[model samples]
Every structure is written in C-alpha cells, then in structure tokens.
Target: MEYVIKGYEPADALRYFEEISAIPRGSKNEQAVAQYVYDFAKDLGLEARIDTTYWNVVVKKPASPGCEDKPAVMIQGHLDMVCEKNAGTAHDFEKDPLDLYIEDGLLKARGTTLGADNGQAVAYMMALLARNDLVHPPLECVFTSMEEIGLLGALQVDTSDLHSKYMLNVDCGPEGTVFVSCAGGLLQDISKKVRWEKAGGDTVSLQVRGLLGGHSAAMIDHEMGNSIKVMGRILHGIQKQMEVHIVSLSGGSKMNAIPRESDAVITVPAGQGDKAIEIASHIAATAKAELAASDGGLYLQCEKAGATERQMSLADSRQIIEFIFLVKNGVYTMSMEMPGLVVCSSNLGVATTDDTGVQLTDFIRSSDPTIRDHLDDEIRSLAQLLDIEIAPADPMPGWKYEAESPLRQLFMKLYKEQTGKEMVAVATHGGLECGILKDKMPDLDIIAFGPTADGAHTPDESLDLASFERTWNLILATLKALAEQ
Candidate 1:
C-alpha cells in the first residue's frame, strides 16, 4: 500500500513535512519528537540509538552491494523549532501542532511560525530510510534537540561511538546555494538594580508596536524600524519637554527574535501630562513619515492605567535609558566579498524591569570568530560603563569553507551534468549545524543544501511544493553518482 500519511511519501517530501506539522517540537521540549523518530526507525527495522538526557536519535542503514567498504556518511538536522507567534495569536506551541496552510504558492502558519526551518529536512531523511530500493553506502542520520535554544544537543552528542567520516547537513535556506561556511554567535545578558521611588501624582503607560521585526542578522540591513529604538527615541523626546518618572519598562519576547514592540510605564506630572502626549504625537508622526515604506503600521500611544506612584530612582532610570540608546542594535558591516551579505551584526533582543533589577538580552553574530568576540567585548564594556552585571553565554563557531573539498567538486559536476547550469556555492551569515558538526568531526567533509524556503525564522516560513520534488530528485541523482564511484 502507498503511504498517504501527512508527511511520509517517498516521492513527495511534503508528505513527511505534514506529519511534522502535527508534532509539537519547539526548542528545549523535544522529547515527543525524539520518541517519534525512535519509534519510526524501529518500525522500519533500522538500528536506532536514543539518548535520554539529550533526547537525540540516530539511525544507521547498512551499506549496499559492493559499497560495503565505502566510508559511512552522516546526515544531520535539528529537531526543534523556534517558537514565535504574532501578537494576540493564541496557539500554544507546547501542545498545539503548528497550523499549516497554503496561500498563493506559499506555505504559511496561522499567525505563527511554520516549523519548516528544519522540520522539512528531518522529514526528508525519515522518508529516505523507509525506502527499500535506494542504493548507497552505509548511512547515519542524526536528529538533535534544542538546537534553537543553543547547540545544546549537538554539544552533548556522544560522538565517540559514531562511524561517519563525512557529513551532509540539510538545515540551511535557499535550495540553489550550497552553504560551505557560516558565522559564529554569542548571547549576552546585562542587568542592573535600581532603587524605587514614589510619585506625587498621575501615572500612565507609553507603548510602541506594529514594527516589522525579523531575524537580527538576516534582516538588519533592510532598515526596518526597531521597536526598542523607537521607544527609546520617544522616551528621550518626552524627557526633553517634561519631568517623568519611569515606573517600569518591558518589551520583546525572545533573546533571538528582533523585538517588534515595547512598553514603558512612568509617572507624568499632571502639569506636563498633556505635553507628554503632544511629544508622543510628534514622534509618531515622524516615525510614520520615516517608516512609511517599511514600518507604516508603527504605533505609539499613551494610555491611562491604575498604578502605584512608586518608580525607579532618577539616576537609575537615566543610566538604563542611556545604555539602551548607546548599545548597538543592527547590521555592523557588509561583506567585502559578498556585496549584500552581512559580515557582522547584533540585536538588543529583549528587556524588562522587575522588582530586583532590569534585565536585558542581546545576541551578536559574525562570520569572523575574532569579530564575534570583539562585539561581545563591546557589549561588556557597555555594562561596565553603566555599572551593571553582565553575562556572555555560549558562542557557536562558524563553518569555514574548504576550497579543495572533493565532495563539493563531485556535487558541482553532478549538477552541471543534470541541469546544464553552474551551481551556486556560498557561506551564510546565520547559524547551522555544519559549524558544530565540523567541530566534532574536524576532517569530516561537509555541505548543506535544501529546498527553497523564504521568510524562515518567522511566520512566513514555507517550502515550495514544486521545489521539493526537484530537490529530492537531485538528492537521489547525487546518491547514484556516489554509488558509481
């Protein structure tokens, strides 16, 4: 009987992709999906290894015919998705499978992110395992957990027992390009505690929203408005004309996603309350005119709310506000070789004020390891300047491309013979398993390829129905070429 499951067809990868859509596998919570892979592999009679602590699964397929002596190849892709949603979208990623639908030739989520970033690749590998007729050398397929949160699972992988000397990672964007290298990144947290004070009169909240936020490294150059920056501009504008005491400030949802909105609560003297609104209006007008093409929907509003007149001390508030203004929050430079590619960047991802202290999170990325470290140092200097505690978390290393890779040459020849066109090979500015896997298996030849996926790490994540078939055909053709060799 032909498999008609949501995401399990041998000919169409979408079949397997549909099955992934029904599973809840957001970052750090990958137990269910990990078990699914284990069960799926066992049912197919493949040798499966499951790691309980890390929730990693690996499946091995024996070599075919005369290829038994060939070196084993590893196929790797992450199992977790970045859980992000639109404001007011009410789907829980922990329990609810992503709601997937098609519109105008693009697959999209219902006001949330479609987990296609790595899900499609996972499904594709699973489908390959179910096939009985395909011929190739021995294979090892690895599914890692919590890659979105960090390369935690990959880091925890017990590589001592692995048998692969070469790997092909399927967790990258753009089908036509073969990503041979990528950038490294680091996450930093800056925090400060300030004394609270009581206000004499009325208190209100100011909010900025509707900005087009995106992946800080990928979309930073677009010049789309930033919610945190917009809020800072308004707050500074208000401070110019009147005396306002900040009660609290909060915005952003994740340490990775660009913050699309922010809110601040402050006590506005009844005398200058009207003036505060006037200044906000002026900021909004300027933003509308400036962001008319990109952040046209940007909004700034002041609303009355019931609150204690208690607020942070004046000195504390001033220092925190100044820090936000001084911090770097966008594309730092462009690649000299790859005109449009971002060589270095950073994002002031999130910030919030609480009873103890104000916590802020920033993420930085760069293709050069030295530059990534430099950026982290710059942020640490900011914390020192403001007398705040700072923490820099794990840094993911970049994949360095090999100019003399035999596998790359093989792929290039295969594509030219199959399509009569030259293949596009380049390095990406985003993180991929290629970097970590390379670190684990230094001599392992690696290359990353996938179907056409646009607007990844966002609500518009989707796979081209037509591209899936073509890409799968290419994968199969490549396998045939390798078998002949």
Candidate 2:
C-alpha cells in the first residue's frame, strides 16, 4: 500500500503506522494487530510474545549500549481502535483496513475514524524498539487489546512479569501536556422488556442526524448533541399531543461515542400521521435551536413509512421515554479547584428498542468516587421505579494527582528545555489504561502524552502532522534523560 504520510522523522513510526492501519483492529478484534506486533518484534530479534485470552503483546528490547544498569522502562498503549464510520462508508472494521489520506497538513481516514488515538502509541513503540542508535534504557513495549471497550484487555494483563517502575503511557494529550490524572468511570447497562401488539395505524419515521458526535468522555463537556437523547425527546413530544405506539427506536454503534444519529418509527391513529409529523418537526426545530452552538448541523427528518404489523405497548414505550428523561447525562459537575475542569459526567451512548424490549448503554465518569456513586444512585433509583434491570460494571479507578512524580517532573523540565513553553499537567475525563495499570502495579510511576488529534472516537478524526513529530522527539529525549538518571 502507498503511504500518505512522508517526510516525518522516525520515519519508521509513520511507515509502521501505515502498515498497521492496514490491519483490522476494532476493539475485541485485536488478535491480528497483536500478532503483527509480535511478528515485528520477532523479526527485530527482540523477545516478543502474545497471550491467548486478551491478545496483549509485549516486546522487550535490552538497554542501550551504555545504559544496561539503568532501570528498565515500559511504554504502553492499546491495540484496538474505536470502529466508527460515516453512514455511507464502505469500510468494515473487522476485515477491511482504514483508508488513510492527507488533508491540509493533518492525517485522516476517508469516511472513517483515523485510529490515530492509540495507533500513534503503537507505531512509536514499534519504532523505538526497532531503533538501535537511540539512547534509552531497556524497553518494554506493552500493547493491550480492547481498551476502547472498558479496558478489558488492559485489565486482564499479568503485570507480574514486568520489571519497569517508570511507565510512559502513550495515550494522552498533545506534545507539551503531560497527563497526570484521569477520571474513573463505569458502564451501566439498562434493559427493559416490552410486549408487542398488532399495529393498525399510520406510520411516521423520524431521524435525528448530522450531529457532531465524539468521545462521550472527552467531549461530554462540549455539550454536543446526543442522538439517543434527542430521539427520546422527539418521541415524548409526539406522545404529549397525540396517542402513539412505538415500532422501533435505535442509534449509535459504540457504547463510548456520542451517537451522531438516532431514528424512530411509530404508529399513530389512522389519519393522525400528519399531526405526529408536524409535532415532531416543531420539536426538532426547538432542539436545533438549542444545539446550534455545539451541534450546528443537527437536523431531524420526518417522513411517512410503510405500516408495520407490530408495535410496542404504550406502557413499555412510556416507561422507556420516562427512563431516558430520568437518567442523568452530559457534564454533571465541574471541579471547583480546577477551573473549566469537568469532575463528573455521564453519557447516554446508545439506545435500541426491539420486539423484546429496549436496551440503553450509558456510562458515567468522575474524579471523585463519591460523586460517581451519587450519580449512580440516581440512575439506580430510576431503574427501580421503572422495574428495569440496570447492571453496573465495576468502576475503573481514577488516576489521582500525586504531589511528587519524578517522571512527570523530568518530562516537564525536558519539555521546557526542548521548547520555550511551560509543560502543563492535566487530567482527562476520558478513561485511560493508566488507571487500570496503576491498580495492578501500585508503585508504577506513570505519565502520558501523545500527538495532537481531533475528533477522536468519531469518523472525522485527524492527527496533527506537526505535533506528531514534536511529541515523538520529546518522548525520545525523555527516554534519554531517564536512561541518564
């Protein structure tokens, strides 16, 4: 395959990135990518291996020529990418590779997510392991799978074999910022059963689309429109004015993405289809006005569809709508200590309804466990009222801000010396594997940084070419400094 990215230092990083991008590596489908990494390590004559359960890969390279006595260092990243694409994209996350391209100095994938979120980390690690001239300590490049799906793979890895105390997580913000902390999060799966009845009425289909959906955790504070929530409002609004029965309602592909589109099909009393459409259009107009600042492209389209035989009982439909309204979503609270920092939030990522019932995938995050629990309690109460089952997974622990981090300080000093700007330490609301790894290796000192990227977890994802190289150079320099210490 022809590479779109060129003239980048550590050219191996971009070359390996292009090669890996050609493999299908959607979350839970990372076996092939893991094998690729293992193969690359084996070819380099490095001690590389893969596991059966989670497909986590580890490649070990001995210390640089003069740094054998220095403490070993671990650089980690996830192997999976969030598989999201535009509606018309002909890509397959399980079999087809990403179509990489270059646009206006940024690297992009046509109609699909660029996968640079974690790919950069993988490529950089590969490049470093393959480079013999670079001054560095013993290298341990750990690639875990299924990180996009609740850190499943990272949670499963056995850290007992690792010898590194200083770990660099390559999954944070752009070059200058070294991430010190991140919020903890959990997924709450809500399901409710519904009874279907024969439909004998006119059909109206409503689609809410074109919203600027993104990473639910990182972009929740942006207040972008959530399609599932939008559809819920539209459904409720139609019911307020006229009797209706829901035929189907669904949207969203990933449990961690702000759904870009939502769709609903319902049946109304014969001859009342026009009224339903009119009410829906009015509600859409109001929603558009509300979303203009963040989701300017949001629009709702309503049309008549061929009649269906079965529809959900009004009781079930009402229960689902009420549950959606009761659920707490978006940025719940901001930190008082840190200005403009979102301390707590939840996202209604996906909503789907079928003949059996409706299942809603929602996630919550908070730096404070107490606040997270409080929000969970609210959702638990809603589930109880609706007599629905809400299964909450064990929460991912938050990376707490430490008063003293030698690795962080080192990076800060090196960043200041390398560039004239002060390196800022920050926390992401998005869940990083750092928290999970810290839980396993309590004493592991961790810091995270990456190249500039935009629209992560969405199809519009792009990587900043300039920041990409700057970050690579900084990481190389940081590694050299650590070896010297």
Using Cα atoms with residue i matched to residue i, what is each candidate's TM-score against the true structure?
Answer: 0.77, 0.73
Residue 57 lDDT in model 2? Answer: 95
Please provide, for model 1 over 1-485, each residue's C-alpha lDDT reduced to its tens digit, 9 standing for 90 to 100: 23333444354557677777778889888998999889989998999999999899999987767778777778888899888888899988889877777777667788788887788778778877877677777888999998887778988877776778667787875767787777777888788888887765557778887887887766777777778777777877787666667788888887667889999987777756667877877997798789898768888878766757588877777777777777887887677666577877888889898888688888888777777788888878887888877874778877765667877778767767767888898877788777777777788888888878787778767777666666777776666566667
> Looking at model 1, which ten-residue stretch has the lowest summed lDDT?
1-10
Candidate 2, residues 1-485, lDDT tens digits: the string is 66666664554688888899999999989989899899989998999879977899988899989999988889999999998999989998888879999889899999999899899999999999888889999888899999987788988888888898899998876767888877888789889988899987899999998898998777998879888888888888888877778888889888778899998889988999999899888988888898888887888889999989898888887888778766788999897656677888998998887557888898888877788888988899988888788885788877766768999999899889978899988878877888888878878889998888999899999999778888888889989998988
Off by over 4 Å in 1: 5-48, 65-71, 79-137, 146-152, 163-165, 182-184, 200-205, 237-244, 267-289, 296-299, 302-308, 400-405, 426-428, 452-469, 480-485
Model 1: number of backbone collisions: 4
State the TM-score for model 1: 0.77
Candidate 2 similarity to native, TM-score? 0.73
Highest-TM-score candidate? 1
Error of 1 at 171 (Å): 3.5
Task: List the lowest-lDDT window of 10 residues for candidate 2.
Answer: 2-11
| Every candidate's lDDT | 0.78, 0.87
